[model samples]
Target: MLSMREFWNIVSISLCVQAQISQQLSDTGHTWNYDDGENDWSKNYPFCGGTHQSPIDIYSNIKYDAALTPIQVVGYDSPGIDHFTLSNDGHSVKVSLPATMYISSLKHKYTAVQLHLHWGDQKRPQGSEHTFNDRRFAAELHILHYNSDKYVDSQTATAKEDGLAVLGILLEVGSFNPTFENIQKYLSQVAYKDQEVQIPAFSIRNLLPVTLNEYYRYNGSLTTPPCYPSVLWTVFRQPVKISQEQLFSLETALFSSNVGDSIPQPMVNNFRQKQERAKRELLASFKEDFTFPIAIAFILGIFVIVAIIIYIIRKRRARQQSESRKRVMYAAAQKAEGTSSIEI
Candidate 1:
């Protein structure tokens, strides 16, 4: 005998295998908009206004932590399932991942929950949440996970500190990528809000960068409403590439409105504006070469300034010498005239 409360938690808010693909979503049927309700998220959800927020601006001065090891996964290559449910959750596109897949190398076993995306539109394409060196990419992909060892499921893990781990893959416009195409090929099928489809499962590891050793690690929160500051963020340095056509499809393929609404809104610019990062340490697995390039540019600038100063000094000295010569010649001519007058 399942109580209605238990059933609802398992079905509506579950991100594990027993649950749906996403948790902390529009599951509450809470109406919020990015364009209008964005500034007012704190009015309804107080956590939106809280400190230690996510999608921070990763500046140049990130500290290199030696303990930040390469992220290891258990069963990402083989999902062990034929198809996974894909849905347009009115905010973003989501795909449910099985609990069989989890990250192994972390201190606790962080099981895979679901993966979703945030993107911009044809007019404004910089939709990525986390910006690196103040550069925002075209789109961003988030693979959500929960601490399986500490909590029963993701729904229970949502509120706890250090309970979530999300892998962020930033996308840029480039050549066609087949791994992303596995999900993108089915975009047209689930274009409207609440539209669900069964997309064939593929290797989740392919979604990540080829080299997992280099990444930026930080402590942040979920980018959406009811923003929980539980996520252990890992944003890869190398961005995933997709062609212009693919990016356009992501921007314009979906609608924010449900299947039947008076006015359908294009689901563009679904990303939240970055929040303030107050006194939190940002770590990197590999040391960034920010100084080498800056050092070269600084030396070149100094040389240019010195060259200009030398040119100005030489020009002034030449002009002064020319004026002195003219004065001396005029004086000599006057003296010669006086001598000639005396001889007369």
Candidate 2:
């Protein structure tokens, strides 16, 4: 028999999961059946039939029509309340109400909360999104934010079409990133689970891509449960790189211990299942195939028009020159005939 406290703890945790998943079957009528234990490739290796599986490649056959207006970054503040919040274990960081932030298709301002990482013992070569260009990132950072206006009241939690946004920044292996170093300074205290430190002076705006002007935007779920399909996702076309050593340090820090004693398993692959397109256009900012052809056609058309104008101008000039030369020759002939008369 469990004590009252223990029973409440169990109940509390259960309710939290239910709230996050929004009653198992999502509001859009899809069921989430992917549990880590159930979907383990070694055990469920050849059997799990659920479409909502983990580690699906991101860019697989998805073609975005046009990219959205890059979200404006108002400002970034340190880790503080309503500004920067923490997870129970400091595994995640959130920033709220980012100033001047905008999503192309949405109708509200989004507040970024915390950013965190997900990784495997080795960087999964295939990557988190099922169709990344044949390789996986060392780790990925998800910056989570919610619509401040939509959830203004407590009663509107499950409302669909609510304004929620998440920006997924893919981290690849490369040289050092200054932002990563800034984040690392806090790990000494809050690196472990349930240990959180608040640094209210770090500006998240710097973390954005210099070319946020272009990206792929789509409607997708939270990747995690309640698997809320409310997210308007803006995944950038550019990838930021971190050194292998830095990557290892960050991965190590995510473990149950700061020293990497054991693998830390929180939400290994929290990305949601790709939903039906529902006839919505996936926007890409810098489109090559479609835009390139149209641009080429436009340039050729302009060139043709300019060439015609040049030809007409040259013809007019040549006609004027010919007339002037003829008049000069006629005048010379008359002058020669008059000179013979003078000689007699």
Candidate 3:
């Protein structure tokens, strides 16, 4: 019953709506490992080519700033966070946290939002996004926070400078980290993208190192696409240790494709390459002095050398005493033989 013009108008409107929907879906379901012509994210995300990109290689020659305040995290051990959600977003596994936890060190208090991880396979081992002295870790964890004082929410804050603060903790393979057990136990539930499970929350502070004072601070953009240059990054110098078993779960337990997909792909090596550090200063909280481990090793080496010298001296003294006793016995025998010959 409609005229030709009306029909064309409706068709155009429908086409526009479909295009918008497709764009949204593409943004949401972006994957890291894509070989198709659609893999180039710079075309889709213009900010990927921005100057202030992240995941930079931190060098040991960073300037030590004594004025850098020690990070103070409040409510990280709160009992209110009894439950949380963990999800597999195809790229990485993310754990959602309540806004109750916040950092008080910065000028404006930043509230905690969520944390995620980046990892690599067993063959490569090192998958952390940020590196220290060109050295990468087995995995990296990022706890994202937003300036709650000025921004109403994290979404709004992501586009502004001095908006988000990310705490980066590197993970090394060593001992079993019980702090990670809660999320690891439920990783299977979220093996595929868009899958999520509820996990009992524990002390988030347990995940951080004992000393939060020493770290590398820089201003950079998000490592992911739409790389917003708003994050104030604080990567700790010390890395936390996790068992090989835990690393295996992180590498092999998750699938990038959906459960119903024709081909199953494991989600590993989700980290971005190190970007150029263009006109940025990497500030360290503490000066690079003799490390505790190095000092301990030096002391142990000294003790071993002293122990060897004492043992050699004692052996020499024992040999000399034995020779002196033999000489005295020989002289006594000779005097007795001479006396017997005289009596004869």
Models 1 onward score TM values of: 0.84, 0.57, 0.76
Q: Which pairs of residues collide in candidate 3?
A: none
For 263-304, candidate 2 gives per-residue lDDT tens digits of 655323333233334445456666545688889999999999
Candidate 1 has its poorest 10 consecutive residues by lDDT at 14-23
lDDT of each: 0.86, 0.54, 0.85
Tens-digit lDDT string for candidate 1 (246-267): 8998988898888789898899
**Shift in Å, residue 138, candidate 1:** 1.1
Compare candidates 2 and 3 on TM-score and give the better one: 3
Clashes of each: 0, 29, 0
Model 2 stretches astray by more than 4 angstroms: 1-35, 38-56, 60-67, 77-106, 123-131, 153-159, 256-281, 289-344
Q: Provide the lDDT at 129 for model 1.
A: 93
Model 2 clash tally, residue pairs: 29
Q: Per-residue alpha-carbon lDDT of model 3 for 32-75, expressed as tens digits? A: 35334213656656556667789899985589999898899998
Ranking by lDDT: 1, 3, 2
Q: Find the candidate with the highest TM-score and give its number.
A: 1
Off by over 4 Å in 3: 1-39, 290-344
What TM-score does model 1 achieve against the real structure? 0.84
TM-score of 2: 0.57
